[model samples]
Target: MTANASPRRWLFVLTILVGSFLLFLVQPMVARMVLPKLGGAPAVWNSAMLVYQALLLGGYAYAHWLGRFQIRRQAAIHVALLVAAALWLPIGIANIAPPAPGQEALWVPLLLIASIGPVFFVVAAQAPLMQRWFAADTRAGDPYILYAASNLGSFAGLISYPALVEPALPLAAQSWGWTAGYALLVALVAISAAARWRAGGEAVGAEAVADGEARPALRRQIHWLLIAAVPSGLMLSTTTHLTTDIVAMPLLWVLPLGLYLLSFVIAFSTMDRLVQTITVVAPAGLLSVGGLSLLSSGGGSMMIALSSLAMLFLVATALHGYLYHLRPAPRYLTLFYLIMSAGGVLGGLFAALFAPLVFDWVYEHPLLVLASAMLLPLPALFPWDQWLGLKPRAARWTAALLVAVAAFACWKMVDGWTGVVADVKWWGIVIFAIGLLVIGWRWAFVPVFALLMLGVGGWDTVQESFSGMRVRSYFGVYTVTDDPEHQQRRLAHGTTLHGLQRTEAGKQLEPTTYYGHQSGVGLTLDKAEALAGPDAAVGIVGLGAGTLACYRKPGQKWTIFEIDPVMVDIARDPTKFTFLSECAGDTPVILGDARLQVANQPPGRFDILVIDAFSSDAIPLHLLTKEAIGIYARAMKPDGILLIHISNRFFNLEPVLAAEAKARGWSAAIRIDPSPTGDDFSDLTGSNWVALTAAPQRMDALTGGIRPRKDSRNEGVWVPLEGRARFERWTDDYASTLPILFWGNIIGDRE
Candidate 1:
């Protein structure tokens, strides 16, 4: 910037940075606050994400609409809107009633919009609006550079929440801190408004153009829309693909989004050489890392995850850099942003809304990966024209030949993986060699990428997705597969195994998977009659294949509570798995969030209450809160045993439960059934179960009355649960997955 402009320049940059920071910080903060109300389903996060995208589009449109007014008039209106939005100070979830069973689809958006809609809309407009105002002088030296600073602030806010803010302070503190930031933004906006106080300041660049400037051509404008949408859709799709398909790592959801926001920072920055380098390398990333990351995450789940992330960053930066290359002058700045935001919303809709409804698996990830190949700026890796010098007709024929080769290579690759081809490894090399040759040709590159995808594991993913064996619900995607060799059928939520049952005649009656005979819940189920009398009234939350139903006695009255109706269907269908049909065929399955539904159960109704409602590796923070403990305590008989199955690969949930149990003075015991081994290992598995009871003797009975560890080695030995130090007591107001994360366990070769 010129020496005359430093003061004004820094102020405008700071204001945009601050506003952008607040705009992103509110997302995780408010989403954390609402978990208690909505339960910790991954869909809740997806819904919240879609709502934010829609709101952002609205904010950008609002900014574009303001271009019609003079600078002072625009400033006055924005400031007034900011002040009025202050009524939603210390932002959090709204006070409205929680959604009914199937109404969460409607309720989550309503709740989010009602909570922070006004404040978010006002702050979200700051980046584009403030940039436009800064350009009022025409000497502000390319107002577009501030967009880099805006996304930088956005990246910082998103990363800092999980790393610095949430771990350091609770949700309430995060919210009030954001509110304070908003107040400062209001003052900053007023100061920016005062910087240029010329009444009827002919709108910046309102004067006649330099004979060549007008709106971007219709095709160019549409290019901007599509260019913006691919990365936006890929962001969410990549998150789902990595977490659910590759590795069910808790809190990994934030990485894709963080990289996405940072891409704009890199792309829009003044570092032209860096942008040029990423653009050049991105096509290779699409060819090498993109489809390969999805084909088969075989020996390297971690490597696959890292490569996929690298691919996302490279592709996003390259596409967005090209967007910067096509940018218009400052006159149509807000229009450009409006179209960009609209595209973001559309992409978000495709990934978040469209995929879940239309496909059973995360095809959007691979589909967008293909779409990236189509939209990415193609620069020749080598002198294709000089090297080949082929005529147009020859080129077309060669392209057709390449298409056939790609299809054959992909098919062979799949055959190799399935043992149909003798040299699978050679097939991969051939596909890679052919793909590398066509990196500069968009038409040729796409077919290679698509075929290469199927050659890897994309073919299997496609088969499974469309086989009608997978089901999508508000909660998650569940797939039921028959394991004939193991004589069992398995149910899976993402890569995490939900449950499996023996398909054989006699063994089908056994409770397998996490509820093996020696498991804590298994032992408690066996001795429940001794502890709570014969015909014990039992309630089980999370009906995963109804594996625990076999633990029910002839006279025991067992009730199952399941949140997802799709899961219920899978469990109840005898054709899928017979655990529910054979054991609890007549049992009633209550639907809704386990916590809310448990709250409505008649007092002292259950003699043995079990909380087992986990979906894959992600544990529900809301279910383990003290308030939820109170609900569980009220729903069970005074001396009844409360069993919780904390079988999560992503979290060490003992601390959350240990803290609540300590506070309530409940007797809690921890049991570890180390994942089973030998032939039964595939069906029966180890589980971490915590048994708590208000009555000490009941705990003693569950623990074998001061049991000795001298029992059979295969059986789990109950030990007193020790409270973890310096742990947060999760509540409706505050809960974070950072504390209890099994960071090392995030990557593994699991089914």
Candidate 2:
């Protein structure tokens, strides 16, 4: 049973691939399953990521410690651990109830750790452990190449979950599929262990490899940690940037993470040419695209999103290629991975936890980009010593001049001293090109790059800082902007405009934006008295600048439910947006998730219930599920109307609502309001709203004269649920946005 004759190498590779695939696959799958329970906030995903990173670090440490034992003993212990962990399989979160209000941060991680901790720990260790086993058993090649295979499997799993798995399979099927994969991985591990045992504990280089190489120094280890830390932090920052600023969808999460893993695949592969090419071009990608993204305040959001993703991939590739170049010998493989995982944890902590508390903006994104530039390999562009005598003094003077210029530029831009220069986008491009050429000089490159980031985007940060216009919370970033030209003020969440108001003192009570007097929600409110009688009791799910409050009548009892406390504060403060104070003063506002809060209310209490809760373009899936609809139904009077604000940039949710309404035996009417025209002071924007009621007469009365015509998609206007057979009714057990995503309109929508 010599090493050369044994087939254990392939066995080990298969085991690593299967284990790593399941490891990354379960991440998004379980997170998606728990999204409803956790209220669909992006912070829940971040917290879940932290838990995974911490567990991965622990798993790596365990592998490194187990390296002290003989191969036979190590295999036995790991197999036993895997077997014990399998008891928690058919992987699903245990019936740990949703956390109490305000406890989501603590409880999300607690529940994840309790549900999948043991299983995740075992699978996480497979990569490093199997690689070590290969190093001990074979004398053929470096064992580290197998790491590329592991990441390849990881990339495949992540991409497939969103593109293939999620769209095709429900949660129950995905869970069982993952369980089957885990079982196969266990069998592969057993076979690999038996192969090692058959080698009679005298495989090639078992002792020699361990004693052959010197341990990496503390300085070198720290360098490895820093290199690994940059990409890890950058990955999370990129995810936040896209989801928070562009679109808050789960599909967006997979893009950055999949690219991040793919970088490892490309960097660690046998393709030396590809790695070298990327390493050469990465700095330019960061300088041009990354710098522009930071500086520009407004552009086509899809273009910005694509550019940002490209920048992330290029930067990650260069950083990871450098890491591969610095790899230690096979003897220190587990130790190397352990230190790298530790850096990953620190990076996750900084982006997900620290940045929100320390900075009012998404400052981490540009900061990490700058850090990536600093760490990139600086190849010499010209021979400075030969051309200019005495290189040291010339370098020192050059560095000082660049720093001074960068500082002066930032000062001028931030202080509004550069009036016309700031308006020209080409000026920033020229400066970025100069910065790219200076990468040969470390001192010059870092400062020049930092300056470009500040000059392009620094003024907005300065404006926000001085005016206190931006607020970051667990939900996302909210900015209050005053448009002097339009004589209006707006509250925006990410790229989506939440609410707007006329700036004139007397017009502050008028509703604007999507809630204008003639919009879908507006028309529904206008007819509320006719549909539900005088003095109707109303409930609103989302409190966006409190615009809906303007629709309240004198004797109406209106209540609003909001999840983020920061939003509640902004809406209630009269100086910010006066819709709440000017109209519905002293109205009761509940601070919690809408579904949960509405469920606890007295049954049959409200004449109308409005569902306006959304994060950017994301429809909170939890709110639209059948169970959630049931809860809303229980809280409403028998003939009460349900006004659902389904206007979104990335989803056509009318079909979804129609399907759900059909299942509940409720008649529905959809109103697609035309955009306002010709000096209309209402500031109305086009909107789509669906009204559901058990009483058909009420729907007919509310939708008077707004005949629903069949659209190009053959989707009829005000048609019964039978025409929506292509759409599935979402429930607590299953839902997928794949079928309804507005792919053709992604570029036009500022989601």
Candidate 3:
């Protein structure tokens, strides 16, 4: 390569690197700005990714089309686009109020696009486009190394936002910081364009190469899509498994995504050895750590094991990186990326949308593990020809022996073995070693140990997921377990506890789970006489294990509106819990979304409605929208009170409720109770409930009936919810999780 050629290649890499950094940094920066209004959640981040990818595809297509232009013309056109995008900047959302309560499904995505569309679209395209330009301008270069740099910038952006930017600044300052970064990116692009302009006629013009020069056929492109899609999907799947299915913590979510980005860095860099080494270790880790993920360590140890699982993610990343290394030339770059994007979108759809609908279980996690095992390159145990030295029949018999032994040992370990069984550790270690050998020589051993390890560890978790023992509703998973001292039933939404139940009088009529007797719901129910008469009609939006049914009094009418029929079945079945059978034998369990169900209900029916509908980490914004609020209000009596269970791990929803209360005239107060860690019946149950009422006198009655505490500064004003006030309303029709909920520290100057 000529000295001048080397300079051109480096310059190309630098341009892509700068462009990528700006591209990714802008995402969190914009998300942070809207978080105070949007609320924080994983879905918000997912939606943001979609926005970035969509705009990226658009930019790449534009760059591909522009390749037909003379170098000077392309530069001029791009510079104009950059300038036009900057006009809307200082980089922030427009001064628009958030979608009305519960409109997040629609308004959040729309608002995100409106706020950052131009800037994002322009920046996102630069990587693929600039690399193609480099291939045109540089006398000779791969341009793919620059692809690696772009992803490195992406990794830097994701890591820097949480670790450096968010911790250092508030939302407002973050916006300015990003604006500064965008200006720098613009400067970098200008420098490259200047270089290309100087290169002048040397910038190779597009040529119609012979059809013989064409690359992979359509079949190969489709193959590339599957390879790319599976790993990309697995990355997200790992996140779901770690957080929702296993440990549901921020670190878990960030680790897998971080590793994924880092993998691209390793894959694209001039380092082949690092990528190869990670892939070799990947298979062993997938089998071992994947099995470990199945162990129920509650919250603490599960977090540690989840971190270990990051190794598996790194492996997947390495494999994906290898794919990029083999990526086609600039002429076919867009096609390669188009396929890549399709895979990414499909994976995301499965994780975010379809998985919730298709399987009652969180299938993403296991599916990802399976995909990783298939994709990661396995080590060859022996020479192919040497293996043939053994008779074919003998080889087959030996393979069968290994399988039988592994299967039998697995069965004994799980079924025959009891607590703290002797030799269990050694046995497991030996089995793992044999499995590794099998993975080395035979691909069949992959599934063999996959099932073996899964059985000894993973299958246990799966079996524990049986009906009556465990429940997965749109809201989340609820588990009931028994011990020597006491029996307990717990409700968990993505690693966060929603409710817990303790044995009462040998029958589970204790309303001490999520809405335990000690909770705000319990406190109100205890004073049911003062709030309403015995025949008062009570409504509950979510009926988890029927814990609240125990609070029913004789002749009192009760109804439940639940979206997931599975949850109702779990709670009502005698095997799960008898909260309904023993308390309210005829508790009307209504199915479907609460908003639609409540709208269809008779007006002035419920005197007290407890709103507790949530699917795992999903907060049904539709249910809380202004329109839904009106339906709720209409369904209740004049003096009725509404209890909203707003407990979530990732967001501070109080402000949202405060905004609603301020917008709509109503009397409201927040009751705060910490979860009990002790064994005492009264001490173990805790909850936070917000009570709203149009009648101040009625709210006063409920408040007066409870133990008085210090005034709350957090609770905002009470304002009646008008119609679905024109803010964004999140409906099933249109929802994007991009505008992160509680993206507090990531945006501007606030720390």
Q: Give the alpha-carbon lDDT of every model.
A: 0.82, 0.79, 0.66
Residue-level lDDT tens digits of model 1 in 255-294: 8988998899988888999989999888888888776645
| Model 2 C-alpha lDDT per residue in residues 229-294, reported as the tens digit of each score | 989999988888787665555367778888899999888878889888888778778877667546
TM match of model 3 to true structure: 0.70
Q: lDDT at 437 for candidate 3?
A: 62
Of 1 and 2, the candidate ranking higher by lDDT: 1
Show model 2 residue runs off by greater than 4 Å: 1-7, 97-101, 198-210, 246-250, 381-418, 421-426, 705-723, 747-751
Find the number of clashing residue pairs for candidate 3: 38
Q: Name the top lDDT candidate.
A: 1
lDDT tens per residue, model 3, 1-751 = 5766555677677778778877777776776565534434444666776766667767766776766676688788888899899987888777666466467567767878888888888887788767766766545466666778888888788777767776556556777777887788788778787777754422432332332456768877776777777766777666666556554444345667677777777787778887777767676776666655455433533435455556556666656865765576556765676677677777777766667656555656676666666666777443342457866666667666777777766766676435566655556665676667666544566666565556555666667666436655434455656543666655555455555556555545556645755567877777676678878789998876677888888877889887666667767777656777778778788875677678779999988988987654455565665556778999999889888987654445555555566667777777766666766654154456888888888877777633334354222222222223332333222222333355542222111
Q: Model 1 scores what on Cα lDDT?
A: 0.82
TM-score, candidate number 2: 0.93
The predicted structure with the larger lDDT, 1 or 3, is 1
Per-prediction count of colliding residue pairs? 2, 2, 38
- Report the C-alpha displacement of residue 29, candidate 3, in angstroms: 4.6
